[model samples]
Target: MNLKKIILSRTDAIGDVILTLPLTAYLKKVFPETEIIFLGKDYTKDIIENCPFVDSFISWDAIEKNAVSEFQKINADAILHIFPKSQIAKAASKAGIPIRVGTSHRAYHWNTCNRIISFSRKRSDMHEAQLNFQLLKGLDINYIPELEEFKDINLIEPKQELREDLKEILNNGKFNLILHPGSKGSAREWGVDRFAELIKLLPKSKIQIFITGTKKEGLLFRKDLVVPFPDVVDLTGLLSLKDLMLFIKNCDGIVAESTGPLHIGSVLGIHAIGIYPPIRPMHPGRWAPIGKKTKVFVKEKKCSDCRKSGRCKCMREIASIEVADYITAL
Candidate 1:
């Protein structure tokens, strides 16, 4: 298959978008001159805007009818549909791109693409990053040694005046710890009482808490949270995606559940304690961040509800002291 222009469609949630970056980077590493375009959600533009590997990024929302009109100006050689069931794929197919590659898994609403690579496994089989990369084998780019892990940063800098304003807000402030108690992965959260207890455990005199989330999670935080400290900075529903990333970069560390921010922190090399439920899988080596600074807290239990979304009895048994001890070690 002679692929000159390529499009990777991964217009899903944040973690799925982040996990697919390795494929884009690998495509660039193998075929540096090839024009690589990424199709993702509108909000994720910043996540990949600075990726040197990607030639251009097109918002999936822009495909009103099909990808032909939007990508026609760009002149792509082929399209690689990561989440193939997306309407964007139909648009790309309608656009008359010669070659299209995607996963062969028939579980989800699998669409008809020209070339489908079969990497079907159980849901618990492989990391999403690896599965996405396997789709590239049709282009003779199949080697998937672990990609070089690095902090993901965009080049978008605030104006000089805005920078000064941020500096003023941070002046004379104690070290801030991002306490992200919000997650979309299943409803088995540690609850607000646990978060309040965690705050009470921290020495509030030396540290501050920034409760962060989007508009949905902001509502969740308010509904369940009982703040034990006065220094809590509830910035939920306030910061944009890039703003949240910047805020996380400045913080000392993050203590969060299995959320997007946790993965963001992992990508940034920030020390994070991922409060994983006991029922979840245990191999951080394959799934979570690979660096030494990241620590995962998953309690082992006899009967785990590991159906990817069931209630996990193991996570409920985890204690705050163990988490605090892990933080102290970090």
Candidate 2:
């Protein structure tokens, strides 16, 4: 196929978009001359902006808002649909992109695309990264090693002011330990009482603790506060996603619930300890950190709150001393 311009679409949340970045890196590395375009949501743009692989980026919703006019403007040779939807398929069809490739589920139709491949819905069986990798098969790109997939994208350094601010907080040359207590939804949190107890236990430790998350996480952060804990700092709702990355990279280790920051810490090669409940569907090989230094602390329970209910039972079982011990050992 003499494809010069390519549109890769996957308009999803932050973690979903991060997993798909390897796909972008793979495409760009193999076809260096190819003009790579990413079609995603607004927030996705921020997540992928630093990716050296993408030639140009566009938001699918922005195009949907002005379908006809936008379609005429983006004249591409092929469209790679990561998130296959009727609206996206319809727009790609109307744009008259010569080739179209995407998943067959959701909104399947003759008008959808000529190269539609079926995507599995089974949660436990498939890794999100591997699912995105499946799209490569359609483009004649063979399977590559997991670690080699990401072409070394340059590291984005945090702003000087932010770095200085963080440095001041760390008076001594102490190792920073980041704690992300709350996940995006209510289903993932390990609870505030447990975190508060943990903080109280780590007073004299050499580890400097820092907490961060979105504005919604402020409620949980306040609840997790201890009366007197030396070198404990809270920056919840203060940093941007990029700033969060810098903060994590600067930290010696990370202890977080299964969320975006955990994934970020894994990618940064920081020692990350993920706290998750032991459930049937949860597979370490699939969801656990790809880095060797990363460890997953799963508390096995009969119910395991994660199997049927999304709430984590194992996290509650893990004691404050256990978590503190793990960090000290690392």
Best by lDDT, which number?
Answer: 2
lDDT of 1 by residue, 1-330 (tens): 456889888777775676677677677767787888888888888776755677788887776555677867667787887776656666676677777776767433255477777866344456656667777775767665543443333222322122344444552456567878877653256666677767767766666667887778777666545343556777788777877776666666888776667766666666877777644343333355433357887664545464655655566677887776666554
lDDT of each: 0.66, 0.69
**Candidate 1: segments with Cα more than 4 A from true spot:** 107-111, 121-124, 147-174, 185-188, 223-226, 278-287, 290-292, 301-310
Candidate 2 residues 262-284, lDDT tens each? 76777667787787665644444
Candidate 1 matches the true fold with a TM-score of: 0.84
Instruction: TM-score each candidate.
Output: 0.84, 0.84
Scanning candidate 2 in windows of ten residues, the lowest lDDT window is: 151-160
Worst ten in a row by lDDT for model 1: 153-162
Error of 1 at 318 (Å): 1.8
